[model samples]
Target: MGNLKGVALSLLFTSFVLHLPFAESDWFINYHIHVTNDLPLLKSPPNQPNLFLHCKSKNKDLGERGMVKGQDYTWDTKVNFLRTTLFFCKARWVGHKTRSFDAFVTDRDEMPCRHYHNSCMWSVRDDGIYFSKNNATWGNVYPW
Candidate 1:
């Protein structure tokens, strides 16, 4: 009986420690996902009406938002210790078109963002969706 009690207590403590927010490793915290609407480059008014986005993870839904040219929708989340944390987004170009893709992929984003500190950054341009790894350069990730 005493051995069982000790094992239970140890398991509880281990779970608590592993689930702590913002552990010593940056992998456990400060994960920011930035989604921007940079449509209509040469016009004062956007040609594609407005940009609508809905982003969420398995345990959380960030709802939906409408954005205009130069507008942004950003959020932050703490990555799970098991490395199962994933976040994806669905973007719509108003009356034109829409696309959906994974925004924060654990395995794919972990190494690149290891030193990023700010984590995954996504840009929604008139051409397509672009992604940056805590760097200035952006790559075309998805097209609408």
Candidate 2:
């Protein structure tokens, strides 16, 4: 009985030490994905319709949302342990056209997002889609 207890205690101690969380791999940082509506809302014949958006990752769905001009939608998440995180979004203007784009990918966004205070911003305009990591300089990434 004494020998069995010693063996059990040693096994438990080893498992406990092995399971302890590591500072590096177990650490987490929050990242934000933001989308804005730059196009006109519903109005006259020449005006655009309310922008509808749906965004999702492998683990999360942001549910469809409608936006007026200058409105923004934002969500925060932590990059997964395996580093395969990705988020994509679809946009539509009622009477106009529809578009889809990748909003975030761990491989592409990890460095810039970490460098830019962990945020990615996107703008949907009449002409095209724009992206900015630091939220200052913007470039057209996709066209409608």
TM-score for each candidate, following the candidate numbering: 0.75, 0.76
Model 1: per-residue lDDT, tens digit, 1-144?
Answer: 999999999999999887765455755566777888887643445444388899999899999998877777888876676778889989988667799988888767766665677567788887899988865989998977
In terms of TM-score, which candidate is strongest?
2
lDDT of 2: 0.83
Those runs of model 1 whose alpha carbons end farther than 4 Å from true positions after fitting are 1-27, 41-49
Error of 2 at 77 (Å): 1.2
TM-score of 1: 0.75
User: Which residue pairs show collisions in model 2?
Assistant: none
Q: Write the per-residue lDDT of candidate 2 for residues 1-144, one digit (tens) a residue.
A: 999999999999888767755334423878888899988656764344378999999778999987878889899877776667889999987788899998998778777776678888899988888989888988899889
Distance from true location, Cα of 47 in model 1, Å: 11
